[model samples]
Target chain A: MNKPGNLIGWLRKKLNGISRLWIVECLLLLAFGAVGARLVYLHAGPNEVRIQKAQDASEFTKSLVPFRGRILDGSRNPNILAISLGVHDICANPQMLTAATNTELAVSILSAYLKMSKEDVRYKLRFSDKKFAYVKRFVTRDISERLWTQITNNHIKGIYLEEATLRSYPQNNQACHVVGFVNNAGVGSLGVEMTLNSSLTGTAGVVKGMRDGKKHEIYTRRTEEIQPIQGDDVILTLDQQIQYFTEKALDDAMAQHSARAAWAVVQRCRTGEILAMASRPAFNLNEYGAETDMSRMTNRVLSVVYEPGSTLKPVTLALAFTEGLVTPETMFDCENGSWFYMGRILRDYHPYSRLSVADIIKKSSNIGTAKIALMMGDEKLHKGLRAFGFGRKQGVELPYEEYGILPRLEKWSGLSCSRIAIGQGIAVTALQMAGMMSAIANDGFLLKPYVVKSIASSDGKPRFTAEPVVLGRPIDSKVAALMRYLLARVTEEGGTGTRARVEGFKVAGKTGTAQKPVPGGYSETAYMASFAGFLPADKPEITIVVVVEEPQPYHTGGVVAAPVFAQIAEQTVRYLNLEPTEPVEGAPGAAAPAP
Target chain B: MARVNRKKNTADQQIIPPRLILTVLTVIGVGMGYLGIRSRCEQLGSEIKKLESSCEINQRRLENEESKWAGLMTPRSIEEALTRHGLNLTWPRRGQVVRIYDSRANDLALVDMKDAVRFAELERVALNE
Candidate 1:
């Protein structure tokens, strides 16, 4: 403002300042460019790109596949008791479905096809805010296919199929109790199903797909998948054909005897594997709803508890003989058929003048048996019974097995001891009785009974296998053999179990007629008749126990139960194709009186 | 005093370089960007693992259902199904039988139990006459 030279100098200084500012701007831009280039290098580096690509590929390919296990039989044959298939949970986007063409008609058609009511469909469609709602779960393949056709043909919108699983039993009720039944969500409920549920229930897989903002699949750009691990298959010891026959026989017996209930079991004598176990009446596994709660239960040969009657006599005799307190020739006067102890009178079914230790068993004399028990004393008898697996669980591979009642020696009065000696006052289950018989047949060695043979993975590799387990030897083998000989006579010319004779088979068995316990004491009319025996008396194969409760005309074990044993033995021998032995000539007739 | 001032002014006239400042700014910016990118990668990896596990579970469930369906839809089961639905297959009676031939011996015989009985009766009547 003061001079021209001063004004030119100020303008030059301001222009120079603007040029320096531009140079500073250029330096800042260079720094930013280096930083941006470094960032790009870090983000798109080889390591980072490789990791991203691997992750995307894995996510895309791994999610949607599943592998389930198979259920196989003893022969390694697949009997699909339960399995999985591709199915769908029918769902809908309620708002979309409502806005679609022919909404009412679509809902009506879906409801009819799915067996759901149109009202339910309409109610779901009314939920406008709900992005998805399920109409039904676990639709079958046939139904799903039909639905897919219907949706395509009718142009229904928003109805979709999602993958799910459904369990089915092919044999249905054939092996229902053994194979067990699975629930709606594919959980095992009973039998082998529950036992091996963990191995049978394979791991479930998931599907992850790229989705839009509304959670709809957008071409599935990336998916993450993991394959499921299938469960193991269980192999049972049950022979299906044997099981069929056992069930048929039990059903017929139950109907013919007008029995309230009946149960039977056939076990391998050497090995404790149960070949067949049946109870009547039984229900179908597929139609579980149609059965009553009572029929749905598995008896496991342990449902009923009754006095073992004369079947217990052999055990007592075996104990006495083993203790050196009695010999086969040892004789008891039998009090001329009846004896009184502690104001209780015990009588034999037939009067015997005198019976040797062997004859007492052959005749099944109650008085004679009580006399032999008196010699055994309370402690040795109790120990012997306990060792024989009485008053304790037999350790079978089944649930809810009962340990029958055996009162302690201290609890037994003189009368109680005498009564219990002849199989009264003490109650035992049929399984326990059978186990006791099997122990004798197996040379005094008790075995822990089991039904499952092995558990294998879906690839046919064994996961767990069962072996024949010897529990304990309750008596000396010599004593068992002698007892076996005496028992064989019970099916001979003058024995009580004359009716239990099988042709060309040397049968050894005992007959039991236990009076039913009434309100006050015992009933004379009602009886629990039982016959327990091992076939081919010299060398045993199978041991069976047949119990008949309260027959109409005759309630004696020899008359009611022994005949059933004979029939079962004949059939079993024929079916097993067992080598026939020479018949015991002059075997007593079933009509003959007990000797 | 004037000569000393001239030498000091010449020393101050040397220019400062911008490389040091530029290097420092570039390091700070790159470090921050790398951290952000690393965090995004970790997040995606975890999400992918979760999705993978879920997919595995679903796949197993689907396989289990498929085997069950195949088992229930067998030929034997179909025949049983028909029987359950009350459809019975019956054989023709003796009067409807045509003839029987023994394949091994090439011998012709009566097909029906009733016809065999009738032929046996005719033989007995002829012998008696």
Candidate 2:
């Protein structure tokens, strides 16, 4: 029994040792197999989404918005009319505020700095389920700084400031319509702002890199970085000094006449550069959205159209002179101020029996001017008017320019030639009238008006420059010279536009008091009083046009509009320091001031 | 016999290779230099980040100041200042204005009489009309 027991014990020990070895080997083999499988799977696996999610957790790509450009006024040392200033949007992360966080204190502090109600701040911070909420947008720098200091000192967890830009018009309503205003969506809405939006908006940049727990970029681990390109700055042809003078004059006129609206344009005759263009009832650009009436935003100088009245008379006479149909000396019978032609009565403002062509213009005789148009006929007149930039857009650097209504030849009635010659049956913009006067001023060459003078990049590199563009030569220089001489007489003692005379300059211009066209034929009470002309007629420098809409009791163009023209011309000529074409009273060898 | 003993003593001394030692020393030196440069690069990058942030803050402040200056420099503000100061100013009279032709500032009274007469032409048409 002892020998068998000993043999059994020895077998058990041997078997236990072999089985334990096998178990250890099996476990090691399994571990090795598992590791090998994982290696293969990692190299070529269907875990693309998982890998991307992991990468996204550690990597961040941020897009940076570039700076919007500025709008500058035309001066030797330019003034910033419209600018984009760096501002901050105060925001909050409600999720970051824990139970231990004193949210009430944060809200109280935010409301005080943001100038908002405590309830508004509390609602945004406590009740909002959103991770992010804007407390106030475009806060001033001082407010943002004070809030940041409070947050740091109090150890507030949720509040942050996001960088932003605010478009600021420093001139306020001075050149509001010209500089235009930006909408809530940060888009240029009108005038040159809308026209040059693309050039003003710059390209955005991108950065790709790793981020830390605090969401700050790990610069050393950055993979890609593309820098942003800033936008181009636009320099306008509008001189701020001249623009102020113009706006003041329009405001005075609006108050004096109790007119519904008024608009004016002052253009450099040689360059077609707009020195000053103003529309009445202008709203402050900084508070553009406050004015509920959007019609006040209309730039009437280029957008509004009306019957040109006697202002078109000079254009007609200039056309006639171009056609060689009549000289200044050509005589025509006025038929005692009224003439019946084609079933319509053409009448002059004052009675005249007979007058030469020059005297007809000087006296503004409607019958005599219409007789000359009758000789030209409808075809020649329409063609001639088209050549003079009528019934078309002058392509100025402004939006909503109206093509003043000149009917097609087929639309002309039998009396069209007679009536149109007297500045009826034709609609025209103030810009067109100014351009026509500019043509006469610039030797019969019609120039395209432009407001933007030049564009420069953020690096101060010139991107574009606007030069004087001659649209067409509607009349010969000889005819233009003769027309200028004829128009100059309108500001003389016996002419209709005598009020338009500048004291030290030879003022040449025409006045129009057109009755507003209503649903029937024309309004008996409402009239548009307008004057279009230039100064120093021999060497013209500037052309000015003033239009007052629906002026009370006094509605004559000569009485209402011409004085405004003279006021603008006098100041502008003095500001430009133009050579005195007139003699001084006391200077040696000089004559007295003009009558 | 003594010289042979000296030679034997010299032969018993161990020999070392200069080239092998130099190669190992160069490898260790290069490794230490690479580590130093890498550490310096990281320090510079951190400094650059700080500077960039400071620059951005300064730029924002500058823009704010410039915008405020522009607002104060507007024509309306100047006019208001004038009114506040009670400064009564007017445009110079025609006779009082004297334009400098070219670079010269000669007295108008002493200028060529013919030039002054040419200026007189402006008034002639007023009487004629």
Candidate 3:
């Protein structure tokens, strides 16, 4: 091999022979290429894969309204009686809409979907000066969806949809009283809405984000986002089917009897769950604003107080039985239809010289009822009725509920006891009368009436649930059973409420044909005909109270209200599928009695 | 003599060809130019982010609307619509339903299976009665 030094010398000589111009050219080209690559990266990388960032200060932010919750029926089916829907509030960016090619086409589409006059909608849209104006607010999601589709398909620009909630009653006027209505200003006003306002009104959301000039959110510039907490939905104890039937019956009765008003309440005997409570002259929850008469807004069943007529007899007799004063078989000497007692005359519809205590209730003998009241004394009678949830607030989940007028025992005169005994002096709400009857049906335990069943989260988890709250056992269970037995006789042949009988079910009820109290004395023409009853006498499932105020012509309870009671009870029993247990002794067409 | 000269020329050309070198530089310059264009598209990037957020909000609103619309088309509403259209459908009477109670199981069953088995029995009873 050659010497190592000779190879090194050769290599060095080759490198040294290269031209400086060529070397400089290569170096400069490489350097320029590197710089070019860097420039390309800095420019194109931003355009191609630019990182998201906060937008410039030319953006807008808005408040997002949280949706209100639903009011459903009881635990079983949980049908939505009241619900909040994200209705589309169709707003027009008037400047953009006026600049559009087919603004008329868009306006016509909007008007048809919103159920508005096209001219009105066109007027709202033609204002080029307005940046934004409402064409229609709170249109149903159904109509809005169709409008949105039409807008998108036709490319009819400039109309924007803002998310908003509308309180909608899907059943319309079915349970209008209980479901209540919401104000145009987006607040609940009456009934369950007023009672559970806080729970129904949800927290609103605030978004501190940049928006474009076109009112679109600039997500990159978002600073603060507080998500809304939606409201908890309330569930009610009302059965929609039962409520519908009760309303229909009451409507017919009110119209047929030509009564000033009518109201009814149906309650679960055991739980005090108001299955259906309605008062006619009722307004539609959907069209609540259109109804000018505010009198229809009152829940007459719970709000109006009047003399309950003979419905109070069973309650008084139960008090007497509780006091060890009189048994059901105790005899009373009626002064043949009319008797002078304590300077006032007490009269019966039919003259009876002698009537048993049970017959006193059956005939609704005022003289007999007064003697029973006299035996109990004014103080005992007052205490008994009060214990039955008469004078005090029944603690129902309703606003503006009245506790009917019951005079203090000290204010009562000698005539007051006798008058009160006949259900004339004491003023009681239809609800209070129903509750007392419910006590008898519920083995004398007066439970607090509740319309709200539970409040649930969006995920169907219960936030709150109503438990059966027992107010008191006003009378003994045995006394209640005995009262049920005697009241059943009132619906039999020759009794006052023979018309109250259902074909299949044994009806236990009391009829009341009280004269409406005028400014001076009671009105002879105007009467509050009422029938309070429960069916399947031995084991009652439901207790109903029906009252027709100021009924015309045939105003007796047996005549005006009893037939309606029969219709309601029969339908209700069939709906509930309570088997026919109590059979008629003699029937035109009878099935063999069950063992 | 020609073969020897050609081999020497190939050996000299091995020092890095001018064509190859210029091609690589041109590629780098074009890549840098494209990157510069991409960096200028900040508005488009933000627009994409906004579109994504808008899509999310729209999806939430769609869900809420769908549920409400479904609820509005309940059986009762449908029936009312039918009634309005003059198609009358009466409510079932009590006798039509043959309720079977299983007391041992502590349950009740409402059986009326389409004008068939249970319904046929009801019809037969009706014709006989």
What 10-residue stretch in candidate 1 chain A is worst by lDDT?
A: A586-595
RMSD to native, candidate 3: 12.4
Instruction: Residues A1-595, candidate 2: write the lDDT tens digits.
Output: 3699899998887777477778789999999999999988976899899788878888998897787788999887889988887889998887776343587788788888888899987776664556888888898787799889999999988789998888888888988888997788878999888999888888999889998878777778889889878878999999999998999999999999999999999998877889999999899898898999888899999899999999999878988887889999999999998898877788888989989999998898989999999999999889878888999999998889999999999999999998888789999999999999998987787878999989999899999998767788788778888988988999999999999988768889999999999997999999999999997898787899999999998999999999999999989887776666777676544433223
Worst 10 residues of 3 chain A by lDDT: A586-595
TM-score of each: 0.67, 0.86, 0.78
Misplaced by over 4 Å in model 3 are A1-62, A93-107, A125-128, A148-158, A206-226, A584-595, B1-105, B109-129
Worst lDDT 10-window in candidate 1 chain B: B120-129
Q: Which TM-score value belongs to model 1? A: 0.67
TM-score of chain B of each: 0.44, 0.56, 0.36
Worst lDDT 10-window in candidate 2 chain A: A586-595
Q: What does candidate 1's lDDT look like per residue over A333-378, in tens digits?
A: 9888878777878888898888998889889999988888888788
Clashing pairs in 2: none
> Where in model 1 is the C-alpha error above 4 Å?
A1-72, A75-139, A157-162, A184-187, A202-225, A289-291, A335-337, A524-526, A548-554, A563-568, A583-595, B1-129
Once fitted onto the true fold, the runs of candidate 2 whose alpha carbons sit more than 4 angstroms away are A1-46, A94-108, A117-128, A212-214, A587-595, B1-32, B102-129
Tell me the deviation in Å of residue A36 in model 1: 12
**lDDT by residue (tens digit), candidate 3, A121-176:** 88887779788999988876667878899999999878889877778787777777
